[model samples]
Target chain A: MVAINIDRFVKRYGALEVVHDISFDIEEGEFLVLVGPSGCGKSTILRMVAGLEEISGGELRMQGVRVNELSPKERQVAMVFQDYALYPHMSVEQNIGFSLELARVPKAEREAQVKRVADILQIGHLLERRPRELSGGQRQRVAIGRAMVRKPQLFLFDEPLSNLDAKLRAEMRGQIKRLHQTLKTTSMYVTHDQLEAMTLADRIICLFDGHIAQMGTPHDLFDRPANVFVAEFIGSPTMNIVPITASKAEGRTVLTLAGGGEVSLPDGTALPSLTNDGNVLAGIRPEHLSDTPTPGATARIEGVIDMLEPLGSDILVTMQVGGATLTARCTDKGQFQAGQNLTLHFDPARLHLFDSKTQMRLG
Target chain B: MRRLNPAAILMLVPTHLLLLVVIALPSIYVFWLSLNESTYGSDLTFVGLDNYVTVLTSSYFWRAALNTLIVVNAVVYIELLIAIGMAALFLGGVRYPKIMFAIVLMPYAISEVVGVLVWKIMLNSGSGVLARTIESLGFGMFNWSVSPPLALSVVTLISIWHHLPFTFLLIYAGMLAIPKSLYEAARIDGATPWQEFWRITLPLTIPAILISLIFRFVFAFRLFSEVWLLTAGGPARLTEVLAVYLYQSGFKYGEFGTASATGWLMVIGSLGVASIYLWAMHRRMLKGND
Candidate 1:
């Protein structure tokens, strides 16, 4: 049975539909993330699931019970807000135990449960301190602790780590994933940061223009995005997209990059039927473009280096290849300089092709 | 931090000198006069705290002090409740709350003496609307100004009418400043409506509450315009609060020394209340919370 099932969930703010009819099911103990850019209605969907927002047109069921009309309290869910929403007047102890107190649980049991959750989050020492007295990460932990102490049927996290600093955000991202693993509670998270979705989600729903562009595991999304949007949106230093002319000649597909380069497909490589002379958008991830030629490289292109950014783990190089700029992530131990001409190899198997008019994946 | 520029310090000297001349000088003179014996036209004689001792022991002074204390507490507490209720209603998405808030603030916009005069006429025993309405309701001739409790209640009502808007606006703005996400979090935590208000709204608005409390408290403690303009110390000094007494001592009875002493006492009383509230605010801040 599904833990949370949203059937044709629609959110319309007075004729302007923010989220078009979108449907997805979350399984029990699943860490589902709705990932999108800002204003993509991802947070709206999470709010609808949490019952904080009314489902404008849909049937919502939680663990087989229809909850469309249920108040947030009756929905039996807990949410961690992006702002940490730690009651400034509440001590960590009170904040953690707040849900239990609202339930009118006995004080001794409330204290015990608060302590138990505090121990799990490693916030035992900060229990007496107010949220103002705690650091950002500590406040985040207290926020998560507050949600988890309820042991609710579902957890909704609405960009809960977005307000933290970079280092704290990454650390808390891992901690949240671990918490989900330990509890195995059905969870729905909303975030605009694809990295967080990649790191933490069991399944990710990538939203675009109010609709689900694609939904899959991080591996599936990174490896096989449904369209150009998904392909570009999923990866960091995202997939390089450029229009290319395609044609069938002598039973092999030939391509000419709009940026002024050519590559011929290997024989017997299956591809969608191509017009004699037609244009389609081509997508290649920076990771797939190599600074050095590979043994089985399908094509090689020459270009001058436009710029270089050396991130500690990898070097990201932008090359003025063909007639366009293409970013390539390279870890070539050899030193490279900007404005130098170089040839970068590409493996055709990792290439993504999308129909220009339809913007849908073709090959 | 950058050191203060000498030019900036030099620029501040004029304003500080003005404040010393306009405020500091007169206040020192008042304290000096309180330590001496003087009448409206008599030469000052050094008496060394005799006026303070006399005012402290006088029954009328105690009565007026009690009246001031009662009025301040009654006005602040009542206004606080009304402000919170109105602010909550406005924030609860009552339609046209802005217009309603503006309407409720009408009394505050009116001049204090004018407001008092309007209420005085409205409560007039012979020709007032309130008196006529009460009389029509079989209360006989509604002589409200003579009864101590009723007279004080009238003053309290008018004061609340004048001051409710300020406290309401402060609390309302504070309520607005609270992130909507906190309410969402509370709802998902299974809190009832009452719990949400008590836990989230009240505690989070403590700063506004403290600020409005101090402002309303001290302001009400120094009440004079309404009391003097409406009732003029009333039938047998029943509503003669500290400010009215100060006015009566200097202007009516021509007791300048006693009046200055009363003025100093009023300042001390206001500071006492303010310090308690400020101390509580500081203690809460130190005890931890944003």
Candidate 2:
């Protein structure tokens, strides 16, 4: 069921359109993350949804009522910003109770609501203090508390975890996810961090250049990315992409790589008709390149090792393959040296292909 | 471990010297002169506190004091309202805001003497454009030059116009420095525009407002140019303010002792009023933060 539906929403600043006509429905009780690099219009779209920015075209609806013309107060949505814009003069209690105060809620009820949110955010002791006295993490919690106290129809978080230190970011990520689960509220979270999107989102929308590159479940996006951009953007080390041409060898598919090396596709594969001279990009995730291939292994590459990073459980090995630097996550603890030859294997099903010209995924 | 802290103390010596040569000496001379009956360049006869006592008991002094208080409150309150309104207007991303802001600051740029002169002609009963406009609009022939209340109101308006730019700029910068996200949050919190100003803009800009208030109050108490130029204590000494009273005592009557005593009283009165305002406001701000 749709909780909030954005129908072909467009945002323009003068003659320049920052967010193209983008459409999506946030499901009831679902946490959706909008993930992209800078200038991808993720934040712009979030702001438009929050009613902070005007929508140039199309309609925004909450619970089936068109809200494109409504002010933020009428839309019944809450937002937590990246910078934690807490009022400097107001105490923690006042910041949280501000919305209630604006709504003219009774004094007793407002106090109870403020205390409930403060306790939930574990900021009950700091109620009397102003924002200047709180640390970054505490300020962010107060920002979230301001949003939480309202229990509005929708929640929008725009990179709310980005301002904290790494350890604090991780901790707050867990807290946010737990809070969402407990409240079961529909949420739209925007961030440039793919890791946050992968960890917290029930669904992830990968945006690129003001367009929706792909949107799906995190597992689906990670395993079956729609294009080279998504394939490269969703993974930690990013997917390794190399130009390749396909031909037939021994009644099977053989992809000739950039450096004149060859990698064979899966055995006896039913294939699509292709032009022998057509160029395509072959994508392989770093973790997919294992020495002892997991399952569905059908391709191999012999390359000279460049560098290795021992990341505790898994060693991240760098090697030059087909004139492109490729990173592999390997568990092998054997002594390895640069300039040594190493053979890496990968799953054929995970070998993503995109048309070199259009950069869209291909069979 | 620091010797005489001469570096910091020496840094203050220049300001102290300027104050002494320009302020302290004249002030001490005035107090000494006020202790005796004297005119400029005449030998003074020591009369104890007679000059102060005489000035304090005078009905003219009380009337001038009352006029000063009226102007101070009127200008401070009226200019504050207009400044806040103008500041909010500038923040609305108005087209050509820089040009409009420059125009708004013209009052500050114009010399006080010239400013009051210009207003005097415009407000003149016979040929002033404002007077003609008001009379044409059915208000009848306006003659502020002969009425104390009308004269004082004209003086108040001119004062508000001349001093508005300072407070307007201060409040405008204060509004701009407030993070945009705070307003965004407020809007999401179901605040109407009025509530946003009352809850956020007004509260956050209180410090700037207070500073503007103190500045305008201190200067308004010294109202002289507009009152003197436009009305000159006309219609039976109705618009005579403190500075105008002091000027008349020193120059018109050549009573330097009484004038100096009146000057000292004016200083003390202004300081007392301004500090009370600052203390009350700052206390409220600190308590709100706590």
Candidate closest to the true structure, highest TM-score? 1
lDDT of 2 by residue, A1-363 (tens): 999888998888999998888999999999999999999999999999889998999899999989988898788899999989898888999999998988889999999999999999999999999898889889999999999998888999999999899999999999999999999989999999999999999999999999999999999899888888899899898888999888777787888888887776668764444433656888889888887755654678878899988888788899987787889988867767788998888877767878787787876
* Per-residue alpha-carbon lDDT of candidate 1 for residues A1-363, written as tens digits (9 for 90 to 100): 578889999998898999899999999899999999899999999888888888899889987889899898888898899898888778899988988898999999999999999999999998888888889999999999999988889999999989899999999998998888889999999999999999998899999988999999999999988998899899999999988897778877777888677766666666665433478888899999887778863666678999999987789999886787789999957577999997778888888888888888885
* Real contacts recovered, all predictions: 0.97, 0.89
- Superposition error at B95 for model 1 (Å): 0.9
TM-score of each: 0.96, 0.90
Cα deviation at B14, candidate 1, in Å, is 3.3
Window of ten residues with lowest summed lDDT in model 1 chain B = B281-290
lDDT of 1 by residue, B1-290 (tens): 99999999999999999999999999999999899888866899998989999899988899899988888899999999989888778877887766876798888789988888988898999799987898989989878778877888888999999998899989999889998878888888888878889999988888899999999988898899888887788889887899998899888988888999999999999999999989999997777654
In model 1, what are the clashing residue pairs, if there are any?
A259-A323
